[model samples]
Target: MDAVRNPYTPGTGRKPSALVGRDEVLETWRVALERAERGKTDQPLVLYGLRGVGKTVLLTQLRHDAEKRDWWVVQVEAGADVGLRDLLGEGLYEPLSEIARQGLGRRALRALKTALSFKASYDAGGTWTFGVDLSGASGGGADSGVLRTDLKRIVKDVSLGAREEGVGLAILVDEAQDLSSDELTTLSMVAQAAAQDDWPVLFAVAGLPSLPQTLSEAKSYTERFHYSHIERLSHTDARAAFARPAQEEGAGWSDQALDYVVAESGRYPYFIQQFGQSSWDAAEGPVIEIADARVGVARGQNHLDSGFFRARWDRTTASEKRYLRAMCPGGDTGIGTGEVASRLGKNLNALGPTRAGLIHKGLAYAPDHGIIAFTVPGMESFIGRQPE
Candidate 1:
């Protein structure tokens, strides 16, 4: 039979088995769940990393595992344009309403029904809008802080009510770095209050490398949140990632093909998936050989060149694109900021805007010891294909 089509995706979500090299993340999630179950009211947890490092996949897996254990999970992504009330109204209130409608007692259900109906007056154009006036039954007050506090209380009350039904609450937020300073502070306050009350509320957040510090700056109590920085896979795990999928499909890979896949992927899970999928497609028969590996690498490179990398590359200005081409060859060993600046013949300060843009786009990352490099393996190849 032909090898299985690559179910793994770069920008989209996939399963743990479909994803390669995330054992550490899985274990961290398991420990967090255990702690929550034991009633340890420790602070919430944050999973921070560069984009394409499998943070999203890890969180998705955690949500699935939490559900299997009967935990009530809510997921939200804080976008650049999303605001505080919008998030609270949509992300928090909607879920609480659903949970209440399904299982809460008549009194609790009535409370929710009252709140939902009071808020319904603001619903126009099919979007729920909250007014600045603070006299409403939903607790809108002139003071922004008071309004935020009331919203937090509402969410906490709903969460506590759910826990009484034997379901722990977990709120998973992605792109957390995009949250406004006020919103971050509000969330931190809510989390701290939940912990103090011994409520079964856990937060799992994923964002850019700067997220932890941002959270800390938002609230001093946020220092208690556990931090997990997702990294690329080890060589051993990288090899297994390539082999497992082939074995699962009743197809096999030759020794040379395996080595080439690992070397080319540089142990990045997304890159490994891309390479494995392309290689399996290039295989002549059930067994993938050395020649198949070569064709697969070429095909994978072409796919990225035209699709993944090109989409990001085409969005930059001319000078920014030039800077990217200068930094493409370092591979696993990335270039220092000074070295990159020198190659571009521009002062480090002058290139700051370009560097920031690249980082924001997830095309580059800061490795340990402050070295900046490509976010994905084989990205250097993609950068080279850009017009100089």
Candidate 2:
């Protein structure tokens, strides 16, 4: 019971061996990957959710499964500063380079070499540079549109190359919400082109809750992609998530302990893992009991305050902090924007800044058309710990 092996990492990519409670998602991912292998030409997939909801874990699992089936996988983290060239050049070049080396043909390899060698440079001071080198791809050009076009061509070429080599191609992009509008547009065009050619090129993207809407805004074609929203585990799934790892480890927790942890965690996977780890660490005997859970809760609460909760809190503006505090009592039920504005006695327009700020920091999310709520359960407890 030396804790649940730190399944809930804060900022790093998902740890595959530590992932749990995603069988349903895994099944869906399996179907997509299988469809790609069969050359079905289905629309790409988009996975979105609030922060810490295990979207990363699901994507990582899918990547592993695809690789097992001999699919060539490319991964990129799309950020505000990321460009289409950076994503494509980094993601596609290595695999395509290897394919070229395997003698796919001189033209394919040379085109790839040209694409990868195109470099755009930004000076450490303030200037920009653009030119093609045999060494790297750069971000500065007339427009990212050109870079995006080149990227699409590379993906198409690579997919065709992989098919000839008896493999499929899968592109995985994480943090996709931060991708620029133009970049998303280019990606959609690429997917469409691949489909037209009847090539098997699968795109699996994971990002914040707004990603689907944002992608659609970028390109209407994105509306056609399959979207999966990863959410918190159900109570039963939460209990199983906690109990399964312990069972596999040759240890067990008392029913009371499990119930207490689940109730307190509100079925959030991150919280469940946090509580489970704390309980495992605090248990005095092989079988964790109620008393051990009490100790674990205290320890876990401390960890939440200092670790998970404080990090997000520290990143918010003063006004956003006020809005979060005002919404504390609502917990996961959240509050309407109008109610929050009324409670704060601020102009409705002013609330826009606060709402956007909160959403950007990942502390709040839109639960429905008009209701905004804490992104995680037990958020009130964390907000209550804030300085007065």
Candidate 1 lowest-lDDT run of ten: 128-137
Against the reference, the lDDT scores of all candidates come to 0.68, 0.71
**Largest lDDT belongs to which candidate?**
2
Show model 1 residue runs off by greater than 4 Å. Answer: 1-11, 97-101, 106-151, 217-219, 326-352, 362-378
TM per candidate: 0.81, 0.84
Best candidate according to TM-score: 2
lDDT of 2 by residue, 100-174 (tens): 545544344434544443422211233221222324322223223465556665676667656665667889898
Residue 209, model 2: lDDT of 76
- Residue 104 lDDT in candidate 2: 47
Which residue pairs overlap in candidate 1's backbone? 134-140, 134-141
**Quick one: RMSD of model 1?**
4.7
Question: Candidate 1's error at 152, in angstroms?
Answer: 2.4
